[model samples]
Target: MSTVAVIGASGLLGRALVRELGTCAGWRIVPTAYRRVQGDTVALDIRDAAAVAAFVERVRPDAIVLAAAERRPDVCQHDPAAARALNVDAVRTVASAARQCGAWVLSISTDYVFDGSAPPYRIDDPPAPLNAYGLSKLDGERALLQSNPFGCVLRLPLLYGPVLDWSESAVTSLVPAVVASQAAGARPAPMDAWATRYPTYTPDVAYVIRAMLEQHAKGQAVCGIAQWSGDEPMTKFDIAVRIARALSIDARLEAQTASADATPRPRDCHLDSSQLDALGIGRRTPFDVAIGEVLSAWPAPTPSS
Candidate 1:
C-alpha cells in the first residue's frame, strides 16, 4: 500500500483529507504536525529544514501533502516574518524533502494571490498578490515548482466545513456564531454585494486530491497548477441567507455597511473549474444543498434521559 503523509493533519482541511482518504483504496496515511494530534503523529515543524528533511527521510512516504501555513491575512500582515517562515521557507523545506525522497508533493494554495480585480481567475493567469499572505503563498508555489517539476499546486478559494480544532478555518468558526446569533434572537442578515466568491466544501477538496493522486499513480498527471472551487458563485449575503434558510428559519438578511478593509477579502475571488470538471475531477455542489447538509449535521440538543 502506498503511504501518504499529511504535514498538518490536525487542521480542518487535514481532518477532511484523512476522512476522505479513508474511503479511497490503496493508501494509508501518516499524519504529522507541529502540534501533536490523537493518532499516529510525529512532531515536525516544516519551517525547520533539518527537521523536515529528517522526517521526510524517515517517513519515506510515496506522497506528501503540505497543508500547513499561516493562513490569516491579518495575521500575515502583522507578522510578515512569521508568515515567511511558515508559508515560504517551510514549503521550500518540505518540497526539497519530497524531491529528495522521490515523493509526489501536493501543496494547498489560496485565491488570495490575486487582487480580486479579476473574477473567475484561471490557473495560468499571472499572479499579482496584494498582501503578505498571498505573497507568501505565491512564493511557496514557486518553491515547490522549482523543487519538483512533477508536483501539484492546487489553488483554492473560501473553504467551509466543521472545524477539527480551534486553529482550523474561519469558515468553520462561523458555524457556532450563526447558531448562537439565532439562539439569541438574531436573524440572518441580507447581503446585496455584487461581488461574489466560490466557497469550496472541505470534502470536495479532499475528493480532488484523491483524484489527483490517482492520476499521479497512472503517470498521466500534469503538475503545474490547478484551481478548485464550488460551481455556484454567490455573494456573501447570499450564503448567509442560504444558511438561515437551511436551518428552516426565515431568511431575513439586510445589507450591512460594506468596507474594503474587512480582512482583505477579495471583491470577487471566483475560479474557473471547467478544465478540472472536464478531467472528471471536479464535483460541484450547489450552495443551498451544501448549506442544508452542513445544517443537518449540526449537533442536536440532548435531553435528559
Candidate 2:
C-alpha cells in the first residue's frame, strides 16, 4: 500500500482527508497537526524549512497533501508578511522537500486568485488576484510548480464542513447572527449579498483527493493546476436563509447589496470543475442536506436561538 502524508490534519480539509484516506483500502496515512496535536498525529510546523524537510525525509510518503494556510483575507491584508511566510514560503519548502523525497505534492489554493470579474474560470485562465490572500496563494502555486513539475495545485473556493465552533467556517459562522437577529426587539442583521461563493464540503474534497492519489498510485499522476468547487452558488444572505430554513426559524437577515469589506473580495469567482468531472473525480452534497447534518451535531440555542 502507498503511504500518504497529510499536513494540517486538524484543519477543516485536513481532518476530512485523514478520515477518507485512512479508510481507503490501498493507502496508509501519516497525519500532522500543529496547534491541536494528538497522540497519533505527528507534530511538525510547515513554516520551518529544516523541520519540514526532516519530517518529509523521515515519513517518505508516496504523496503529500498540503491543506495548511492562513485563508482569511482580512488577516492576509493586515499581515502580508505572515501570509507570505505560510502560503508562499512554506509551500516552496514542502514542494522542495517532496521533490527530493520523490513524493507527489498536492497544495491547496483558492479561487480568490482570480479577480472574480469573470465567470466559470478555466484552468488556463490568467489570474488577477485583488487581495493579499489570493496573491500569496498564486505565488505558492508558482513555488510548488517550480519546485516539482509533477506536483499538483488544487484550487478551491469557500469551504464549510464539520466544525468545533460555529465560527470555524464562513458558512456556519452565520448561524449565530441568524439566530440573534430574531431576538425580541432585535434589529435585522446585515448580510453580504455582493460576493457569491461555492461552499464545498471538506469530506467531498477528501474523497476527490483520494481519487487523485489513487490514480497516481496506478502511475497516472495528475500534474499542474486543477480546481474543485460546489456548483451551487450562494451569497451570504442566501446561505443564512438556508440555515434558517433548516433550523425552522424566521431568521432576520438584511441583504447588504454592496461590498463593504476593507479587504477586496471578488464578486463572483466561480470555478469550472469540468476538469475534475471529466476525470470522474467529484462529489457534491447539497448545501441544505450538508448544513442540516452539520447543525444536527449542535443542540439548538435557547428560545432566543
Candidate 3:
C-alpha cells in the first residue's frame, strides 16, 4: 500500500482520486482540506510556505498529488494577483516541500496554458495562454518543473463529474438548474458559440493519475508535460446539448448564447492526448460516455435551503 497525500482531495479531481485509489491500490489517501471533510483532514493552506512544508513533513507521504488551484476563469480575471498567489506560488511551495522529502509530485494542470489558437494541441506545442487562469496554471507548471526534476504536471481540459455536487461553477450550477428548469417546464439558457474545448471526466483523470503513480514508482521515464482529456473535442454548446440529451430532456431547451455574450473563454482549448497514447500513459474516455456517467453519478439535487 502506497502513501499518497492528495491535496484538494475534496475537490472534483481530488474526490475522484480518493474514491478510485481507495478501492484499487489500497492507497492510504490522506485527503487534505482547508475547511473540513471525511478521513484524515488537514488544515492545509497551500499558499503558506511554512505551513505547507510543515504539513508535508508531518505527513511524510510517499507521493504528493497537488490538485488544489484557483480554477475559476472569471475570478482569475477579476483578481490575477490572488490567482497567482494560490495557483502558482502555492504550488511552488508544495513542490519544493515535496522535493525536499523526495516524494514524487504530480501537479494537476490545465489546457488553458495554450492560447487556444489551435486545436488538439500536442504536449510539445508552445503555450501562450489567453486568460489569467491559464497564465497562472502555466506558471504553476513551469514552477513545478523547475523546482523538482521528478515533478510531473498533468495538463487537463474542461472538467465535469460527480464532484459537481459541491462545485460553484456554471457547469456545476447549470446541471441542477437545467434539471429544475425542465422539471418546472421552463427552458434554461445555455451558452452556445463559446470556444471548443476538450472536456475530461474527473474519474478518468483519477485513473490516469494512479497509472502515472504506478509507472513512476517503477522508475519509468514518463514525460512530465502529459495531457489527460476526453477522446473527442466539442464546444460548450455541444456539451450543454449532450448533458440535456443524457437526461432525456429537450436539449433544445438548452439555449445558444454566443461567446461574446458570456465570460472570457478560450476559442479552442482542445488538447491532443496522442502523445500520451503513444507513450501509453494517459487514459482517454469518450466525451459522450463521460457525459452519461457524469449525469448518472450526479446525486439527486435538493431544494435550496
Please, what are the lDDT tens digits per residue for candidate 1 over residues 159-265?
A: 87665432255444444444444444566533545557677888888888888888877877658888888877776666666665666654445655474464566
Highest-TM-score candidate: 2
Tens-digit lDDT string for candidate 2 (1-305): 89899999999999989999878787889899889999689998999999999999998999999999999999999999999999999999999999998999999999999999988999999999999999999999999999999799999999998888887799998988888887888899899999999999988999999999988998998999999999899999999999999999887899999998999999999999998999998999998999999999877565375
Counted clashes in each candidate structure = 4, 0, 1
The 0-to-1 C-alpha lDDT of every candidate, in the order given, reads 0.77, 0.93, 0.77
TM-score against truth, every candidate: 0.89, 0.98, 0.89
What residue pairs are clashing in model 2? none
RMSD to true structure for each model, in Å: 3.3, 1.1, 2.6
Q: Which ten residues in a row have the lowest lDDT in candidate 2?
A: 296-305
Rate residue 221 of model 1 by lDDT.
68
Ordered from best to worst lDDT, the candidate numbers read 2, 3, 1
**What TM-score would candidate 1 get against the native?**
0.89
Root-mean-square deviation of candidate 3: 2.6
